[model samples]
Target chain A: MVGSDVFRAKFFSLYLPLTLYLVFLLFPFYWMLIVSFKPTNDLFDMKFSPFWIQQFTLENYLYLFQNTDFITWLKNTLIVSIVSTILSLVCSIFIGYALARLRFPGSNFLGLGIFLAYLVPPTLLFLPLAQVISELGLNNTYWALILTYPTQLIPFASWLLMGYFRTIPKEIEESAMADGCSRIQILFRMVLPLSVPGLLSAGIFCFTLCWNEFLYALIFMSSGSMKTIPVGTVSDLIKADTLFWGALMASAVLGSFPIAFIYSFFVKHYVSGLTAGAVKG
Target chain B: MAANARLKSFSMRDFFDRERNLGIMLFMAYPFFLGIWLSLTDSMIGRAGQFIGLRNFVDLLTDTIFHQTAKNTFIYALVTVPFKAMLGLGLALILNRHMRFSSPVRAAVMMPWIVPTALSSLGWFMIFDPVFSPISWLFRNMGLISKNINFLGDPILAISSVCWANIWRGVPFFGITILAGLQSVPQELHEAAAIDGASVWHRFRHVTIPSIKGVVLIASLLSIIWTFADFQLIYILTKGGPANETHIFGTYTYQIGLQATEIGMGAAISLYMFPILAVFAILLLIYLRKEQ
Candidate 1:
């Protein structure tokens, strides 16, 4: 009885701190959700009510959709993120396979270079890149972001795919080559099928990254139609005289849903991918 | 005929190899080479300016804004990295055990990371606003303070406000990464320590610390990089306002380059971030090699 009591005490002691930390982490999100539903007047009222929704309404969501350019921003974000992910996956796969399987003169250096490039923060590179983007005459267009974002995505995807491709046994590819299958065929037929989880994780990561990216969207694309969600949301906020708390939170909740869904759906793979890069590094 | 065919095949292989080399060179040419080329010249504003050698570098050394921005970035990074690491480690230690509803709690903790930073900053901005701050209301209601507190209005508090937003967004990264690390440590170590009458602190220090050192190092390095380069959080929340006290390198570069169109100086300031990031990257690479 005493031993069981001790175990329970220890367990509770360990569990309490984690629970509190989670509360702190999750409170703002919960507050956002509650504020999204609350009427505008109640949202500002200095009442300490927790669950009392004085007047529940979907008017904020309606305002976001009907009264603003939220939909256009969503569409633009989807296009850039999706295209960037697909393009990055294709480039990383070929490069990753080559670096993993083929022994070439500068292959090691190339692999290391890609990893180093991944480490170069976009904050540093964006200024020089802005000049390059302007020179290409792609400023204020979605294509500017579509093209420049790959510079950031490719390096990390290549690094991740290289690590993943290395984990697949060489004998599988070797046997395919022994059967007179070309390297391309082996990659398409043998290697890619085995690395789908890694590819999915990379795709989700790239997609979420491009979706959430703010600086480039703010700088590279200036027009309303071209603005992605992050930049667009902020611009909308700036234009408002009063804090549109309900509408802002509503849009935020909606904007975050897709990535949240992707994260929830692929929770295990995402965790593994993060750890594979993080813990291994 | 066979010897001639073999020679032809060898030549073809060599040609393919050269073509592949050229392809990679072409791929990397823009970012690797073009960036350096632009940095050297002073033709950032228009097409007609000539290459003035190292003038931008010299200007950067003497610029007060550059010095202040660098100081802000270092302070931001130095303050946030260790705090987030410790908080994350503490949370992971607490949550690593078998418990009811652990998965749900884990998911809940990860929601902040999943939410977009701009959106979250906006949310926090409202929460910090003097007019609608629930925190101020709560404090007032409890008689802790007689007036509403403007968290983002003061200079030091403005920096702390941005830090709070960053910490909120960043703590999850440490939690998730450290949780993964904690899971990898064998349960037997803890059990053996317990059987040998070792305290929880001993087991944590001797067992958990060594086991997860690589992860801790990598996660901290990554946090340092991200925090140093972070702009969206500060940009939306404070806009580097309250007397430019919160302007880090990222926001400063954006302000100069994009907003003010001081392209050459902006490019110089932005490029300055490379050396610091390179050191972290080198350490990360060494750690990766040792792990392998």
Candidate 2:
């Protein structure tokens, strides 16, 4: 049985610190939620408590939905995230398989190459890539994002999927090969089947990376209708001088909802993928 | 033996394995080389110019604003990394305990990181709003200060504000990765240490720290690299503003390259980030090879 001494130790060491950390983690979200619901007058009023909503309204949400091109931005984001993810996934699966299981020449070097590629952040590449996008006549089109995003995404996906592939028992593939299965066939019929979790984790992680991407989207897509959610929300919502706090916060909430929703369903897979990439790559 | 046999001759497997090479060449290699080339030239948006090797970089050496930005970048990384690493490790330790609602708590803890930085940063933007800031209001109400503290307006406060937001966003990543590292620290080792009459702190310092050392190093190196190249959070929160006090490599590159149409200068600024990051990348490569 727990005594008061043990209880006091647990409370101070565990509960108190954890609670404070959670508040730090979740307070911005709480503020966004409350601010999104408050009317414009209450939003600007200094007298009102920032914690509570005064005369809650949906006008901000309505403004986001109707008065702006939010839906277009959302659609644009979905298309870019999905198409690039699928493209990167197919390409990385082959590469990851090669590095993880194949005995090809220079596989380790190539594997190292892929890992290094992921570390090259977009900030360093956007300027030159912008010129490339323009030269290809893909600027202001979803293709700009769909094409360039893989520069970052492929490496990430390959690195993670390689880790996953290594975890599968090689004997399964050896047995399938004994049954007269070719390498590609063995990959599809045997290797891929046993690695569903890995595939899901890689796919989900790639999708989230694309979804959360900002710099390239902001630079590559300049038109209003073609912008992704992050770029569109920031560029459109905040006008000259005066900030539309409610609509901006609402956009922030709405923009984050899709990733948060997808993540809720795949938290375990995401965490595992994250660790595999960090620890292994 | 297998590698030697396979290395005897080129086969279809080698071709299949090189599948990602073409994409890598086209996407990553091309842009990377182009960025380097751009740094050597005085290229603008509409007009191409002769190669002006190292002038852009040399100009940045003397530029006061770039000096401030460089100093700010180092300050931001220095302040944020230690805080995030420490707090993240602390969080991982706390979460590794036997607790109720552990799954939900873990998920909630990851929310800030899971959400898009471009979006979550907006929430921070609101929280740090000068006139209507809840934090300033709370401080005033608590009689901690008499006047509203300008979070993003003052130069010193602006950089720290950016660092605070970066730490907030970054801690969860450290927490979860370190948590994964923590879980891998076997219970048997701790029990053995305890049986040897070691104190809790001693057991943790010896057993826990050594086991998770690789993870901690990899996570921190990655964090440092990412933080150095970080753009979205600072770009959103302050636009590197209140007079370029908060600009890092990313936002400054965007400002000069895109806004001013100084493509070559922008590329040079971004390439400035490479040498420092390359050191980290080399270390990471060494650690990863050792892991293998």
Candidate 3:
């Protein structure tokens, strides 16, 4: 009688609520997975059960590969994300060290200014940036996004790194200075090696952010070949008169696959970075 | 020779500061000031016009669509933030428990957030399809309604659908951050409160809420700023469609600035988001300083 009661209590309190939440959360992805594999006949058919697949097909994936500029968009997205993330990480490390350890005039004010810069939303800047990019003759090119993304990325990566830098003991740097180590040498040798976790998490975030960015990509890269995945998938796949549901979902699944795969491995570091940045404030 | 020696002494600090500052100027400050100037003019795509100070703002004031958009933006933030806070807090508490398969469960909750908003929103678009919707099919089979419901057809339903998608995307961020805060709260505090004969509600109200207050404040403030300036969900899901009822500042600015080629008016519209965000940023700065 006691064991049965305990089982019922656990079922109601823990298992039931968690199950509901998971269903609510995962059902859309499940739906996308199912619809992407269904043939056009079953996709549009009213009689078929949307929950269960009547038949399986790889037609949508093949169509996405052959019938579109999917490969080019994928390549464009990877290049933009990787290059910008590397640029931001390098800039952030130097600035973050300056503000965190070096005693300089106006450092606190500069730190605050950097954080405030992150608050300037892209929606407010994209219009003026459109003109600025054109005047520089970077319009409809990869350089537009590469140059503009740093405005958001540097502030964020710098702030997160500044917090991480503060947590490392100052005695290590002081001893390095005593041992005739130059400031740059100390940073590259000791500080950089110790904060590898911080660098990884910040880089992961910056890369994912560049991949997910849409507004700037939409505005800057108008040519079909130059477009990133988010912009291309949204603009090219969905036509005005005809909607290709299977191929569209297939693209979404494939586009989100890289970030999802990366995130599953680094969730702990990602979570730590998130709290360290936010709570350390 | 003396000047060169002095330059060598100051070079490191000056170089670091100048390098970072120049990047900020080129990327952030320049665009910001230019946006201000653009809002003051009558510029269009590929053509520059004479300066017209505050005329665009005055004109937007008289435009009815602008008024509707202002209202919609506020509605989006107001409805979504509070719900995200509540649901996120609930999720944190549940996940904080010692449970079976904890890590996988946590990963499952974060999937919506991990995926790109532009793409995951496409999944939502299909779910809300007018015909052949799984939701509609389920509802009809359960005898809840006699006919198919158009999720995006009606103006009110369209905005509601957009808000729902925002909430779904936002809650995981709030949950994960708050979960970090929860873990930092000492386990002894809750256990001590329980030993004092406090009810479950009392223990949570007294012990839990106060400890996590700072985290909650910071998370919600950031969420509010992002939510107010949100773009992707509304853009992909509705495109301010069904007679432009779902338009917010982001989408409306995109339409006027890019689509309509009224760059000046679009800059003016985008500037409206700045003052509201500035207020929250101030509060966040103050809170951060106090915590330190």
Write down the TM-score of every candidate.
Answer: 0.91, 0.96, 0.96
Q: Give the per-residue lDDT of model 3 (tens digit) for B1-292.
A: 4433332353455348666576675678788899899999999987897899999999999999999899999889877888998888988888888898787788779989888899999999999989767999989988899998899889998989998888888888888989998998998998998898999999888989998888888888888888888888899989988888999999999999999999988999999888988998899889988877
lDDT of 2 by residue, B1-292 (tens): 3433432342545346345486575678788899999889999997786798899999999999899888888887766888998999999999899999887888889998889999999998888888878999889888999998899999888888888988999899999998899987789999999999999999989999998788878888888889899999999889999888889988999999989999999999999999998999999888878976
Name the 10 consecutive residues with the lowest summed lDDT in model 3 chain B: B1-10
Each model's DockQ score: 0.52, 0.64, 0.56
* Candidate 1 CAPRI category: medium
TM-score-best of 1 and 2: 2
Candidate ordering by DockQ (highest first): 2, 3, 1
lDDT minimum window of 10 residues, candidate 2 chain A = A172-181
Candidate 3 lDDT, tens digit per residue, A187-216?
899999999888998899899999999999
List residue ranges in candidate 3 displaced over 4 A: B1-15
Clashes of each: 0, 0, 0
Q: What are the per-candidate TM-scores when only chain A is compared?
A: 0.93, 0.96, 0.96
**Candidate 1, A1-281: lDDT as tens digits:** 99999878975787667667867887777767778888898865656463357788999899888988999999999999999889888877877767666666666787787777677777877776777778789988878988878778888887778778888887676666656776667778888899888898888888988988888888888887788888887888466577788888888778877877778777778777776543552
